[model samples]
Target: MHNRYSLKEMFFEHLTRFSAILVLFFLSAIFIVLIIKAYPAIHHFGFSFITEQKWAPNFELFGGLPAIYGSFISTLIAMLFAIPVAIGIAIFLSEIAPKSLKSPIGVSIELLAAIPSVVYGMWGLFYLAPFMRDVFGGNGLGLFTAGLILAIMILPFISAITRDALNTTPKILKESAYALGATQWDVIKDIMIPYAKAGIVGSVILALGRAFGETMAVTFVMGNAHQIPSSIFEPATSIPSTLANEFSEVDSELYLSSLYLLALILFIISFIIIAFAKFYFLKNRVKRKKRLV
Candidate 1:
């Protein structure tokens, strides 16, 4: 029976190792494929493809700056709006909310994440866009509107993950803090947040990553305008939105390749952001843990 258990453990270890390797293999494959498909545009446009804002296919001129700018700005806006709200929701649900209210509120928040992206797009287009236009004084569709929609779409994810993180804090720690005459805010700020900082950071990064890649939800409100937006209320395009809008309409090889290059650029951006968070942030975390040990 001991031998049987050992064999089962060994098998499980090998299976999990294989799964990790498989994920790496898939990531590498996608990068390789994107590079291959985007090579022509890379070679033709050189580095200017990233800096130029023009995207007129009629003139066969393609530049990714507008899309890149829009993507980053929209994501920035989303993170700005979502992070604080998400953290507040997490704190409320984990620490402040009464048990009777927690279940209903938690379920409603989680339900937001279950809604389809296209549904968000529709709602943003018809409802949110008009509201923004009326309130902020711009055409219905623009970066600000898109960013707001992205914030709402990503809120549930960030809140849920952060709530779980905050919940992981020990009851004993809170009790001790209270016993020491610490106020609720003091315990939360000094004890709970410090203890769960890693998870909180992870949740924010996850939401940021999702906001970067959000396509449909952004597309409806962003207007897919291929130009550098002069204002937050001005219409603009993002990488994913550009790809979604023009992929099927490309009439030439260069057009297609440029779109592929845009995809590659987006892939690189997301990979770099996530890799930095995982490697730099998490490595520092490990080093700190070792020092503590």
Candidate 2:
């Protein structure tokens, strides 16, 4: 019964939908291409490629287990360090920060994320590596240093998102908590954290994805060793770093394909993690709505 959109408005709306479909199709096409190119490695190594850790060029043997493990462990360490700090920052920004201090501080934290990845790597190499060596009393490059750098890189991401998530909490919820005689800490620990848990987790997943895929920062600090690390202080390699270091020199087609397969694996891992995060977000959103009702 209302006035319909003009011809240009209708055309623009359809264009937007079609553009989104095209973007999805393009992404699918790229995935297919990468898989096809990587088929040789998958066929040659079978599933053992994922499990076997040795990556020797002399015997023409290769596997990504070590690299994958490094990526996982480094990112996990980053999470252990980043999550608490990011949460603290978020909590302060959302509830405890003075009105005058909030904007400047938030902007500064986000500016950290805006720094170039290469710049982070260079700093990791020159500045962070030396600091780690001085503090930890060992070699400059190791899983720990890589992880520390990754944490610095991922912190801003999680903190910014978490702050936004917490800020989005309904004012009525805070009022209700106050009416119930809940202390500020109690309200935050119970009402606030639980309500924003889903979004915080989504932010974490995104940060973890960045950690797993990070190349320059990790590579500069990881010592670029392909062997399995015995401790967090030991030098190691990650899948992305391995590819970045060696893909250009992979003389054989099988070697090249194997590298591409590693990319595929990373892509799949990220997709699954993000999907889980999305599931958590949607589940919590429903739960939050029900609680309101």
Candidate 3:
């Protein structure tokens, strides 16, 4: 006999559809507003907004190159610092941690990620910033300090996601590695890490996205100088920090338009990272399929 559709499941499915529509609506609204506000600058500057570094508005000259550069560099530094620590945490929790300790430790790490970014900003400003300042001999308000603070802030996200990914690997896959007489390190290095590399990369991308867009946290710790920094010790400004710092107080309409263009660049950066993550995910899926065959 043929089964009829249940009203409850249909209702739930409609609810999920509504939820997705709401999310898309919100995303579209943000993008539309940003583009609408950004068009004046995009029209005026053409392609120079991305390539020119001078941001002064008095001469009718504004550019976002430095802000773009700073955001990229700081996020890069933070991701580099966070990746090793995150991987280590994932390895420990998923591979080596005592069974009894796993749940508590994992929960604590997730709790860290739950902390507000503004709280992190305040902590960085009051505590971590000064500590790094002292350690670095009064030159701490730079990419290094901002990146380090961001690294700590993003650690939980990267670690939690990675540990979850690694933990999801089939138990028999690990057992087979052990059955082959592989050492613990060999099993992890050759078997587990390679298998979960996609998820690990995805986790790292999530953390990097957070670092790239974090406004209050980076603004508080990073010296808000709108210049390209050659050394990590030199003070600089990220795109988000620039918007946070000056968006409200800036006077000219053109000036505000420039900020919107910066926002567009930021949106593009996020889009690129998300695209890369999806590409990697698809590539890994194909590899996994080949392995299964």
Candidate 4:
């Protein structure tokens, strides 16, 4: 029996190690491919590939400034709208919901994440765009509309992760706070949030990552205009949206390479954001541990 248990443990350990290695292998492969494919545009356009604002492919000029600007603005708008609502929902679900209602509510929230991106795009294009047009004007397909759709799409992800983080708070800490005559809000604001700060930050970063890379929904409602948006109501294009719209139609090698370079830029941006989040989380965690000690 002892020998069998040892063999079983060894098998599982090797399996897990292999899985981790496989993931690293795939990531390295993708990074290498992006560097190779994007080299032409990077070499030809140099720094201007990212700095220049015009994307006149007919004249063999391509610039990612507008797409990058659109991506940042749209993500900012989405986070502005999403963060408060997501936090509220997370707080309610984790701390306030009755036992009988919690399961159903959680499931419903998660169901939003399960919906296909294309379905969200279709709904945004057909329903939300018209509503926006009538109420806020500008043909409705623009940065604001895209941001709204992205907010809705990322809401479930942020809320679910936040709720999970909140749920992990120690029960004894809450009980002690309650015994000290602290109100529910005080407990949540002081104990729960601080204890789960790292996880909450992680959730927000994950949501931001999702918002940044989102393609289909943003494409459908973003109007695909390859120019910097002067206003939230003006048409714009994001990096993902640009790639989705033009990847198939490009006839020039430079244009194709430029698109790959855009993809590489996006990958680098995401990697940097994730790395920052991880560093921040670790630093805070260490500080908290020292405080506890």
Candidate 5:
């Protein structure tokens, strides 16, 4: 026997396909436009554009190394500070917190995520920056400050998603483990985490992509210096910070093209990281599910 779709089903299916194709088309168009805008700098600098450190616009010199380095270092610091704390918060909310305390804490976390990025930037500039400067003895508007702001900005997203993931654990499984003399920690470590690994990983990857592309928050506190910072507390710049700080001041074609190149680089890095997580982890998860079946 052959199966046939109704008219509405076919129309909806085709519409969905068209929507997916439209998204791909827009992404390709954006990449093509960036390449076209960045071609001059690509031709002028060749591979050296990525390695050279100088960024003087007056001399027509431009390099992306410092910006790239700052982006990497700041994101690294953010993940270092954020991941453990986010996980702890998730665990507390999911398994440890009393029912009386959960809703208020959960709402507070959602409120943190609700605040604007620019507001986080301003708060970092006025409050966190000075506090850190007093404690660490530096200007405090650098990679470290930018990284902390990013950590705070991303914390709510990671914790909320992770808590939801943990909550998906089957009650039967947890009860059985408890009956078998498993402690709460053991059940959490051995069951809930393994069961919700995919969602947890996806949430972390989502936060990571955000950290890489975050603009206003980093721009306000990253110091926007074009040179490599010798210390984490010294001035630095990331691709987004640099683009925001100088995109309007371009008096030369090379300078503008170089900025476009920086944007393209940021886009490519975020795309690759997200694609890897989506493809690799999802495929492995599917295989694991099949095995269980």
Candidate 6:
């Protein structure tokens, strides 16, 4: 029995290590390919490719500023709308829901996350875009619409992670707070949130990453206008949306390389955000541990 257990553990350990190596290999390959493919545009355009606003491919004037601006604004809008609603849902599901309803609600939210991005895109294009245009005015297919769609798409991921984090709190903590005459809101605000702050922050970062890289859904509604949006209601194009819309049609090597550069930029931004979140979480955790000691 001892020998069998040891063999099983060794097998799994090796399997896990193999999986990790495979993932690392793939990530390195992607980064290398992007760098190689994007070098032409980088060499030709230099810093202006990212700084200038115009994207007139016909005029050989290509810049990523508008796409980058659109991506940031849309992601900001999504985070603003999604974060509060996700937290509320997570709180209700984890702390307030009745036992009978909790599982169903949680499952429903998870199901939402499982829906494909293209389906969301179709729904947004057919149903949501028209609603926005008819009701609010403007073209409707713009930054605001893209942001709204992304918010809905990312909500389930944030909420599910937050719910799990909140659920990890010790029951004793809540009971002790209650014994101390603390209200439910007080317990949640002061104790629960602080306890799960790192996990919550991580979840937000993940959601932001998703919002930033989202392609199909944003493409359907973002109007694919390669210009800086003057307002939320104006048409715009995100990096992902631009790549999706133009990658197939690119006849110029420079244009193709520029798209690759955009991909690299998106990847770098996500990596930086995740790295920052991890650093912040670790620093806070160390501070808390010192306080406890």
* Winning model by lDDT: 5
- What's the TM for model 5? 0.92
What residue pairs clash in candidate 4, if any at all?
A: none
Off by over 4 Å in 3: 1-19, 282-293
Off by over 4 Å in 4: 1-22, 280-293
RMSD in order of candidates: 3.6, 3.3, 3.7, 3.5, 3.5, 3.7
Global lDDT of each candidate: 0.90, 0.89, 0.87, 0.92, 0.93, 0.92
Model 3 is weakest, by summed lDDT over 10 consecutive residues, at 1-10
Model 2, global lDDT: 0.89
> Taking the tens digit of each residue's C-alpha lDDT, what string does model 4 give over 1-293?
99999999999999999999999999999899999999999999999888899999999999999999999999999999999999999999988999999989999999989999989999999999999999988899899999999999999998998898899999999999999999999999999998887888887997898889999989999999999878889889999999999999999999999999999999989888888778877898798889999
- Cα lDDT tens digits, model 5, 1-293, are 12345777888999999999999999999999999999999999989999999999989999999999999999999999999999999999999999999999998998889889999999999999999899887888899999999999999999999999899899999999999999999999999999888888888988898999999999999888988988999889999999999999889999999999999999999998889768756887788889999
* Candidate 2 vs 6: which has more lDDT: 6
Clashes of each: 0, 0, 0, 0, 0, 0
Find the candidate with the highest TM-score and give its number: 5
TM-score of 2: 0.90
Per-residue alpha-carbon lDDT of candidate 2 for residues 1-293, written as tens digits (9 for 90 to 100): 23455777888999999999998999899799889988998999999999988988666788989899999999999999999999999999989999999999999999989998889999999998998889887787988999888998988989999999888778899889999999999889888887787889889987888888899888888888888888888789998899899988988888888899899998889888878888878888798799989
Give one digit per residue, the lDDT tens place, for model 3 in 1-293. 12345777778899999999999998889889999999999999999888998988788789788899989888998988999998999899998999999999999999999999888888888887778778876667877888888998999999998898887778898899899898989988888888788999987886787789888778987788878877777788999999999999989999999999899889878878877877887888898899999
Greater lDDT among 1 and 5 belongs to 5
Question: Model 1: per-residue lDDT, tens digit, 1-293?
Answer: 99999999999999999999999999999999999989999999999999998988999899999999999999999998999999999899988999999989999999989999999999999999999889888787888898999999999998998898788889999999999999999999999898888778877887787889889999998988999878999899999999999999889999999999999989888887777657745876887799999
